[model samples]
Target chain A: MNLTGWKERLFQRYLIWSCRREKIRRYLRDSLPSLPLPDPVDRRSVRVGALQVKLELCKSPIAFADLVHRRVKEAYEAGARLVVFPEYLNLLLFGMLPGIEELEKDYSTGIAAIAKNEQQEQTDVISLPDLFRFMTPAVQPLIFTTFSALAASYHLYIMAGSYTIADQGAIVNRAYLYDPKGELIGYQDKIHLLPVEEEWKIKRGKIFNVFESALGRLAMPVCMDATYFETFRILEERGAEIVMLPIANLEAYNYWLALRGIWPRVQESLLFGVKSALVGSIAGLTFTGRAGIFAPLELTSNRDGVLAEVDCFDNEALAIADLNLDSLHELRCSHPWRDHNPALYRRYFPQVYKR
Target chain B: MLVAALSLAGVDLSSINGYISGLINLLTAQKPVVAVLPAHSALALGLGVGRLNSSNTFQEASAYYFAEGTEWTSEFLNLHGLLAKELQIYLVTGNVIEKDEDLSYQTCYCLNPAGQVCCAQRQTHLTRFEQDLHLSRGDKLDLFRVGNFYTGLVIGNDARHPEVGRIMALQGADLLLHSGAIEGDQTCWQQAAGMWAQVQQNQLYAVEAQLSATIANTVFGGNPSIIAPCETTFGNTGYLARCNPGEPLLCAELDKETLSEIRNDNPLLKLLNFDAYTEICGSEPQ
Candidate 1:
C-alpha cells in the first residue's frame, strides 16, 4: 500500500474518536420520533453538494488540506451527504511549498531557454509532468492524508478534485473518492487531456471507473471525459445513476465554455451530475465558472432538472440540493436508449465518422 | 437568412385552401435563403378529443393523419417554386401513415429547395402511442447537404436518443433539423425531452420545426425553435427563438459562424473514446 492509504486508516481512527461530539449532536436530532425517515429505496433522494473555489495559492500542503476541510464541513452543516470539490486542488500544494516562487521563476526561465534551444539540440521536451516529479515526493502523501481524515471526520463522502501524481514513469491526473468511513474507496484518472495538457506531457488515463456507494452506483468522469458519449455508455452499462464531474477551465474563463456538454451527457445517460468547478486565476490561467447540479435539459427545462448551483463566480461558494433517485427510476422507459437495439447499433462503431 | 418554423393549426380538409394563400404570402415575403415548416403541418388527425387514462387519471388521443399533396402540398409548392431560384425553403411535409408493398410506417419527407425530395425517414423508434397506432419503424438515419450546411434529419421521437445525434456529429454534420409533432396538452412528461435534448447532447446547432396546430380535439405543440451550442452563448444558452402555442412563426438566423467558433474553442470530437467506442462491435459502419 502507498503512504496515503497506510496513513489513512490511522488518521481515520483518530478522527472518529475526536468527532464524538458531532456524533452526539446527530444522535440528539435522530432521537426525536416526530421526524420520520425520508422515504426508502427507490423513493428516496440524496442531497448532494458542490464547492466552487477560486482557491488561493497555498503556503503549505497541510494548509491546503485545512482549507479544503473547512469547505467540506460547511457542506455537511448545510445538510449535504456527499460533497465534491473543484479540479487541480493539488495546484495549491506547489503554491504552499517554501521557495516555490523562486522555483516557478527558474522554471519559467528554463522553459524559455529550452524553447530557444529547440532547433539547436535534440533532447526531451520540458513538460509540466516533469515539473510534477520534483514536488511528488514531499507533498503527495499529505494531500491524501488530509482528504481521508476530513472524510472520516465529517462523515460525508468526498470526491476530492484531481491532482497530478507520479505513476510508473509518467504523471497522471487522478481523482480520489473517500467514503464516509474514510477508507480510500477508489480513484478515476482523467481520460482526455486538453491541448495544453498534451504539451505538459501529462499521460492520459485509459479506463472508465464506477464504484458502489451506499446511496447508489456512482461514477466520476473528470471534465473532458463527459465530452465523449462513449464514457457515458460505459457508465450506463455499469448501471451508474449518479455521475460527478470535477472540471477546471483556464484562460478561456467563459462559464458556458466550461459547461458546454453537461446536459447532453446526463440526459442521454439518465444520470444526475453534480459539477464542481475551480473558479479563479492561477499560474497565468484564469478559471471562471459557477458549479451546477443537473439532469438532462439542465438550464433549459422549466424545473431545470436539478436543485441548486453556485450563486456567483471568482469566489468560494456552495449549494446543496436533493436529487430524486425516484425520478431517474421512473424515467427508464421514456429515455431514448430504451428504443435502441445495441446489437444493431454496434455496426456503426468501427466506421470513422470523423477523425 | 430567415428560417421560418411555422404553425399549422386546425389544418383539415375545410381550411386546406386558405393554407395555400398563407403559404404563398410567406414564400413571397422578403425571400429567405432557406425556410422550414414543421412535420405534420399538412393535415390533422382527430386525436385531441379522445384520451385513455386510468381511474385517478385517464388519457386518449387521435391517431389519424392525412397524406400531403392531396391539395395543400401541391399548392404550397407551386407558390414556393416562384422563389425557388433565390430562396430554398425546406418543406418538411406533415407526418403521414404510409404503406409500401410489404410494410407500413409513419414517415416524413425532407425536400430540397426546388421542392424535390432529398431523403425520406420513418420513425426508427416508436413511442408507446405510436406503437399502439401500429406504426412501422425506419432503419436508417441519414444526413443531407442544405445550402452551405451539412445537415442531418431526425423526427420528433428520435431526438431522445443520443447515439442518433452522435452519429450525425461524427459524420460531420454542422446542423440538425428536428421535425416532429409533440402533444400540446403536455403538462408532465413532455417537459424534458425534445429538440433541445438533441442539440445539447450533440454539442452542435439545430433548427427545430414542431407541429403547431390543433387538429380535432388534439393540441399539437407550436414551440418551433433555433438553438446554438451553450458554449458560444456563454451559459446564456437556450433557444435563440422559441414560439408559444398561439404564435405563427419561430424565425431566426442560423449562425454557422458562432457554431464553428464554439466547436473550435471546445473540440469535443478529439476527446472521444474511439478505441472503446469502436471496440463495442468489431464491424465497420455499413
Candidate 2:
C-alpha cells in the first residue's frame, strides 16, 4: 500500500482498539452515576418524551453514557412510554477518542478565524462522513449496547436518535428503535439529506419503514426527512400512527423554518408527531431548535398544533405529552382527510418524483 | 417583480362594481406585476340572502349566483380583465364558473396582461360545504407562464393538500397563487398549514389572498400575505408582507435571484426519492 493508505489503515486500527467494549465499560464504571430505575408507566394513553439535548463534548464513553442514561431515566420517571433523543447524539462519542480534542479545537478556531476574516495556516480538515466512517466500527457497537441496555432497564421503547455509520460502503444516517425487551425492532434510514450531507458524501436512504409496537405503529425518521411531506405521507399510508423526528438543525432557531417540519406534517397527515432536537454548539457548528410533540389542530385543546414544546431553544430540556391513539384513530376516520384524491396524486406524484 | 395579495372585508353585494373600482384604484398606485384576489369574492354575492351553513340555502344560492347564467359572472370577469389590462399586470382570482345548468365549478382564473384568460384551475378538493352545494370537482392541474415566472393557481381548500403544491413545483412553477375564503373561526395553525407550508415545502413564492367578509351567519376571516421560503424572507419568518386589519392590500417584491439561490442550495425537489413515493402513490405510469 501507499504511504497515505498505510497511514489511514493505522488510524482505523487505533480507533478500533480504543473503542473496544471492555474499555468503554471500564470508562462507564468510573463516570456513570447510580440512579434508581422508576416503576414502569401503567397508563392507557401512551406518553411520549422528547429530549432537547444540548450538544456537549464528553471526556469518555462513560460521560456520554451517563448523559444519555440521565435523560432516559428522567423520561422514564416522568412516565413516558417512549423516549426520543436528538439526531447526531452519537457524535458525542468523539470526545472519548484520543485525537478528536485537537481536531475539535482546530475546527472551532478555524471557524472563528474565518468569521473574523483572519488568515491562518491551512490544516487538513476531515469531512463529517469520513470521520463517521472511520469511527463507526468502534462506536456503533457501544451505541447499540448502551441504548439497548437503557431500553431494557427503563422498560420503555427508546428511539436512540440517529448516527452516521458505514452501511454497505456508504455512510447513511440511520435511526434505531429499541423495544422494551431491549430487542432491535427496526430502523429507518434518513431518506432525505441536507446540502451539507450531500457535500460530505453521505448517502441517502431509499426505503421507509414503519414498525408495529405496543404503542401502535411507530416510525422514526431522522432530521431532514421530516422537511418533506412525502416522508410522513408514505409513513401514514403504511399505517404509522406516531412519527418520531430527531433533528440537529445547523442554523439559528427560526419559528417559521421550524414549522416546516413536524407541526404541519402532523396536521397534514393527522398523525401524532414527536420531535427531539439537538441544541447548543459543538465542533464549530451551532444547532438550535425546540423539541415538541404535535397533533392536528382539532385534536389539540387550544386548537394549536403544539401539544408540548421545549420552552428554550439553546438549552437541554424534556417535553412530555400524552398521545391519545384512540382519539387520533377516530379523527382519522371521521375527518375529510380520507377524501384525499389518490387518483390525482397518482397522476402527478409518479411523474414529478421521477423528474 | 412585485406581487400583491388582496383581502376584502365587509364587501357589499349591492355595490360590487364600486368595490371593484376601489380595488382598481388601490392596485393602480402599487402597479404590482401580479395581483391575487380571494376565492368566492364575487360568488358570495348570492349568500346575501341566506345562511352558509343551511344546505338548502347554499344549494339555492350557488345555483342562483353561478349556474343561472347571471350577469354577475360576466361582470366580475370583465372588471378583473379591465384591471389586468389597465394595470398591465397578471390577475389571478377565484370565481364560480358554470359548466352546465346542473354543474358549476369553483375555479381559479389567471388573466394575463392582454385581458385574456391564460389558465383556469377548478378546485380539485372541495370542502364539505361545496360538496353539499353540489359543485363539480376539477380533473386537471395546470400552470401558466406570467412574465418571467411560471405560476400555478390553487383555489380555496385546494391549498390544504401538499400534493397540489408538489405537482405544481414539479411542473416548474416558481410562483403559487392561492385564493381562499375561510369560513367561521380560523386558527393560526390552520393558516400555517396552508400557503405558508406550501411555499416552504415546494421552495416557491406564494401569494395568498383571503376573503374576510361576513355573509349572513358565515364569517370569512384570514390575513392575506405574500410568502417566500423562510430562508429567503426577513427574519426567516416566511412572510414578505402580511395584510393587517383595515389594510386590504399587501405588496412585496418576489426576488428571482434569492429564490434561485435558495433552490440551488437546497434542491429539495431534486432530492425527492421517487422509488419510495412510488410505493405509496402506486407505480409509475406506463
Candidate 3:
C-alpha cells in the first residue's frame, strides 16, 4: 500500500479511538465525583458567571488558551461555581494558524452571501470543517487538556461554549460541560445551525439533553437555540433548572434580538438563564453585547429580571450573580403553571403550531 | 388617545352617584378617549364592599349576593352603561363579582364608544383568596376593537401568565389593558417590570391600572404605568406614559401605524417556530 493511503487509514482509526476515549473519560469523571452532595443536598443556591470577550486574531492557540484561563481565574475568584464562555471560541484557535488572514478575509463575504440567501458556492475563507481538519490532533488534545485542567484546578463547572471539531467525518459545533474535578460530564451540540454554518457543512444536532450535577439539572443551548422557545419548554419539562446560553452576535440588532429571546424563556420556564457573548471586533465585524445573568424579573429588587450584568458593550466583562433555588421553588406556586387551562390553549397546537 | 389612571384612597359607597359623576367630569375635562379605573373599584362602590379588613367593615362582601346588593349593582351597571356610551369613549374595567345563576366569576366589562357593553372578560387565573371565595375561573379570552386597533383585557393575577398577553398579541391586539388588585405592597415594581417585559416580548403596548388603597390594615401598592415596545414612534423609550405614586391619571397617544411598522420590521410574531412550539411547549411532561 502507498504511504499516503496508509496515513489516511491511520488517521481515520485515530479519530474513532480518540472519540471513544473521550466518551469513557466523561463516564469515568462522572463516577468519580470529587464533591458529591449528601442525599438531602444542603446547598440550593449557586453562583453563576458569564465571561464576555472581544475575540481578535490571536498570535497562537496557546496564547488564546492563556487568555481564556485568565478570565476563568477571574470568574473563580469572583465566587462563581459555574462559568460560561461564548460561541465559536475556537475561532481564536483558527486566528493563530498560518494563512489565517486569508480565511478571515472571506468571513464577511461568506456571511453576506448567506445573508442574501445565495446558493452555497466556493467560500473564500476556510470552512469550519476544513479548519477543524487542519487542526493537528496533538494540538486539539492540548487545548482540551488545558480546559480540563483549568476546571479541575478551580473545582468549578465550565460550559466551554462551542468549539468546532471533526466528528464521524462531519464537523459540529459542540459545547463541553466540565465538572468541578475537571471531568467531562457531558456536551451538547448546536441544534439550529445558521446559514453561514451550513455553508461550512456544520452538522446540526438532533436531540437536546440536560446534565445533572451537584448544582442542578442544567441545559446548554448554543446561540440560536434560544430563539426556539419550545426548546426551553422541553428543557423545563425535563426538569432543567438552569440554561447556560453561549452566543456570538456581531450586529447590535442581533444582540438585542438574542436578549429578547433569552429574557422571556426564563420567565416561561421558571428558571435561571445566563448569557455569555462574544464581544468586540473579529474579522472587521464588531460583537455588540455584554454577558448577563437573568432570573424571573419578579426575583429582582429592581423588577427588571436582571440579577447582574456587564453594563458596557463590546468589552471584556465577567458577570456573576447568586441564585436561590429555594425562593425560585416558592415562586412556582404563584406562576400559574399548575392551574393553566391546557384545553383552551390546545387550538394553538393544531392550527398555529403543528408538529 | 388620552387615558386616565386613577389612584383613589377609598371607594365611598354612600355617595355612589356623586363619585361616578366626579369620574365623568374628570374624563370630560381631561378629554381622554379611554379611562382606566382600578381593578374591582366599581364592585366596591356598587356592593358597599369596603376595603377588606380582618374585622367586619361597612358590610360583608357576600352582601352583594343579597337582593338589596344585587339591585344596587344592577343600577350601577345600568347607569355606567348609558354614561360610557354617551361619553363616546372606549372604557375597560373589570373584577366585578358577577353572581349569575349558580356560578360566580369576577368579570371585566368593556364598553364601546357607543356606550354599549361589547365584551365581558372573566378572570382566568385565581389567587388563593379568590379560590377560597369560590370565584369561577374564566373559560375564554375576548378582544375588543377600538376603531382600527384591538385591545385585550387582563384582570387581577391574570397578567402574571405571559401566555395571556401573547395569545392576545397573536390575535392582532395592539394594546393590552391590565386591571388588578395586588395586596403585596412590594409587588408594584415587579408588576411594572413584568409589564415592561411583555411589551418588548410581544412588540405591543400595555397599560397597568392597579388598586391603591389602605385595605386589611395594609396600604396596597399601586404603579399605574404604560409600556410600549422600543419600536414605537417615540423610538426606544418603552413607556409612552407613567403615573406618579397614587396619581389619578395616565394619558398617552398610541401611534397604531408605528406599532404595525415595528411589528413588520421585526416580525417576531410571524416568524415563530410553530412546529417546535407545538411539539415541546404543548406536550405534557413525561
Among the numbered candidates, top TM-score falls to 2
lDDT per residue for candidate 2 within A49-145, as digits (tens), equals 9999988877666677788988998998898989998898767877765677777777686865433334455765555556677778877877777
**Residue B139's lDDT in candidate 3:** 57
How far is A168's C-alpha from truth in model 3 (Å)?
8.0
The number of residue pairs in model 3 that clash at the backbone is 3
Runs with alpha carbons beyond 4 Å of true place in candidate 3: A1-42, A97-114, A117-146, A163-174, A181-183, A189-208, A223-233, A249-264, A297-306, A333-339, B1-14, B47-73, B184-188, B233-235, B279-286
Output DockQ, candidate 1. Answer: 0.21
Q: Enumerate residue pairs that collide in model 3.
A: A297-A305, B5-B250, B85-B115
Candidate 2 chain B — worst ten consecutive residues by lDDT sum? B49-58
Candidate 2 lDDT score at position A280 = 86
Taking the tens digit of each residue's C-alpha lDDT, what string does model 1 give over B1-286? Answer: 4566666543332443455555656656735555556665544322321111112211232242322223443444444444343345666554555566666666666666776777666767667666665666676667787777887777767776666777778777887777766665452223234556556556677777777665555566646677776655535555677667666666777777777776776676765656555433423321
Count the clashes in each prediction: 20, 0, 3
Writing each residue's lDDT as its tens digit, candidate 1 over A159-248 gives 988888778878788888998767889998888777666556677887788898887887888887776666776787777888888887
User: Which of candidates 2 and 3 is the stronger one according to DockQ?
Assistant: 2
Error of 1 at B193 (Å): 6.4
Q: Report the error of model 3 at residue A141, Å.
A: 6.4
What is residue A31's positional error in candidate 2, in angstroms? 11
Report the error of model 3 at residue A324, Å.
3.0
Q: Global lDDT of each model?
A: 0.63, 0.79, 0.68
Q: Point out the higher-scoring one by DockQ: 1 or 2.
A: 2
Top model number, lDDT: 2
Model 1 spans > 4 angstroms off: A1-43, A99-127, A251-259, A296-302, A333-338, A353-355, B9-14, B43-62, B66-88, B184-204, B216-218, B230-245, B252-265, B278-286
lDDT of 2 by residue, B215-269 (tens): 4455677878898989888889998988886477889998788999999887888
